[model samples]
Target: MTTHALVLKTFPAGSPRGSWPAEEFAARLREHGRGAEVVMDLVADSFLVVEAAPPPAPQDTSGHEASRLGAVA
Candidate 1:
């Protein structure tokens, strides 16, 4: 399987001020069809490493319900 890496800088998005939760970020990636692994530093306030699962084979999107949602880019 192929893998990809990403570097992320975290910041508060909603609610109270604090660093973004790693698990929540991971979950979002999973929802988008990518698996995520996060690495953090003790001193730094930002995240460093993220490894993601390979993208799945493309599926036909024509006539799918999601297509009607809106134009994707």
Candidate 2:
């Protein structure tokens, strides 16, 4: 997990893309303190701001359950 893309501002052609929600675009970038879930406008009027990375530490499986409970060594 680790996504970052700042550019939440820039509209002109066909304007109508400012439904801020994701914590107000992460508070317009407050040193990236919060915000998770936002991916609107990209390229034309740039408007992407997402920062969610902190949930990937749970894969031990206890050594596959000790080899299916066949532990020995």
Candidate 3:
């Protein structure tokens, strides 16, 4: 499971078998540049359309590199 998944929409899981409206909706979101996906919620008896969390910012390593260089000198 992802650490953070925002539920954008919820669809009842009563669609005909082999038909996935939730997935189709998620695919449209993805096409529009959204990181969206569908996940089943058995307890809720529904499909959730979720957007994935953005990745964390890269750590700054300039200070660490400078310290290492100073130690070597």
Instruction: Rank all candidate structures by their TM-score, best first, as comma-separated numbers.
Output: 3, 1, 2
- The runs of at least 3 residues in candidate 1 whose Cα sits more than 4 Å from the true structure, single-residue gaps closed, are 1-4, 9-20, 43-45, 52-73
TM-score of 1: 0.38
The CA lDDT of each predicted structure is 0.57, 0.50, 0.85
The candidate that wins on TM-score is 3
Worst 10 residues of 3 by lDDT: 64-73
The C-alpha local distance difference test score for the whole of candidate 2 amounts to: 0.50
lDDT of 2 by residue, 1-73 (tens): 4544444444333434655444464675655645444455646554445555555655555554444566535
Model 1, span 11-70: residue lDDT tens: 333424564576677778778876566665556654543755357756656755445566
- Total backbone collisions for each predicted model: 0, 0, 0
Answer with 1 or 3, whichever has the higher TM-score.
Answer: 3
Q: Rank the candidates by lDDT, best first.
A: 3, 1, 2
Per-model TM against the reference? 0.38, 0.28, 0.66
Least well predicted 10-residue stretch by lDDT in candidate 1: 7-16
